[model samples]
Target: MLLDTHMHTHFSGDSNADPAAMARSAIEKNLAGICITDHLDYDYPDEPDLFTIDFPQYEKGIRQLQADFSDSLNINFGIELGLQPHLAKKHHEILQEMDFDFVIGSSHVVHGLDPYYPAYYEGRSEHAAYLEYFESILENIAAFHEFDVYGHIDYVVRYGPEKNKNYSYDKYKDVIDEILRQLIAHGKGIELNMAGFKYGLGHPNPTEEILHRYRELGGEIITIGADGHAPDQIAWDFDKVPQLLKAAGFDYFTVFTKRKPEFLPV
Candidate 1:
């Protein structure tokens, strides 16, 4: 029984996939469940309106979909919050107001800039840009404790000019380790996003070495997600995930129900 804990629907500003359709796609792929973790990147760069959602409306739609798809698959309503240290209090207040089954905290913008835009990388070397992104992640996680797991730790690599050509866990092990240690200490977890393959990296976000190191640090809570924004992307590269988990010394993967984790054997 596979559970895809990360995915987006139309409620997310960047995606157009519908919740019911995404759920159907999951059932078609024989998945046991899927969480509709639409993006809610508050104060997004440039197009702030594009990344925000109406929580009440979003929740209503998700609840309807859950009832509609009850017999077909387990449908979970979740949100992917873009974490910024300055927005810690705001995020905490919002989390308290909603009753989401899961939440993924991610750093999409660093220093008021998103690495997805060329402007963010214009004046800096690839190493410097990547380092700043990691630093920002560490700071955000340190400030915000309302999220369940950190999404796409190395997501910035997807838009880099060289992509993953010169990137390796060894290059930024210090900061990455600190990020993992912080999450572990805070009782937080991380996700293995299969979207890396969609971006042509042939691996999950955070890569194999980071996953292994997380396990070595006693970080046991790990979930797998396709980061699927559309129907076709659901369960992307999932058949290969179990092997990756085993290679990283993870005998089980995680699933969340009512914000609590349940471990499933790999």
Candidate 2:
């Protein structure tokens, strides 16, 4: 059974797609289930509340969908948290309060700047910028261990000036390996975000090399996500994910129910 583990709806500040419509679209694509991991990027550079959604309202809305679609598909409530070293306490508190089925920890900001904008790359070389991003991820996960998985381990590549043109896993294998190892040590996993393909990067986030490395280090809790914000984008390129995971030595993919991972054959 294929399940998309990351997505957003109207609740997320950056997205306005209705969750019910997103779920219906997933069913149309023949997906078994999907987890609605909406954005919750606390302390966003200029807008601290930009990605933060009303959890009470969001949870209620998702449960209603789960009931409405109970016979058609499984809908899991989840959240995507933007992690920074300084907000450890805040993140911990939020996680404790929510009843999320899955949590995706991501590094959307580093040193008070988001790499999505060109200014983040204005003076720094791609290598330096990418390295800093990887370092931030490691620090955030190490500081707060509340999330179930890390989202888009290679997110910076999607926005770099060259956009994956000169990026390679070999360039920063040491730090990348460290980050993977840390996640493994904390019993956390990573997601293969298909948004990289949508971004025209010719591959998914973390790429094949990092996926293989994670497996090589005994990390097995791997999930797949389209990172879609709109109905049309749900499960985008998912048809290719199974083969991709097999090449990385994975025979199964993961889903969460009530915060516990359930493995399904790929």
- The prediction achieving the highest lDDT against the true structure is 1
Off by over 4 Å in 2: none
- Model 2 quality (TM-score): 0.98
lDDT of 1 at 154: 96
Residue pairs in candidate 2 whose N, alpha carbon or C atoms collide under 3 angstroms? none
Give the Å error, residue 206, model 2: 1.0
Give lDDT tens digits, candidate 1, residues 62-101. Answer: 9999999888899998999999999999999988899999
Top TM-score model = 1
What CA RMSD would you report for each candidate? 0.7, 0.9
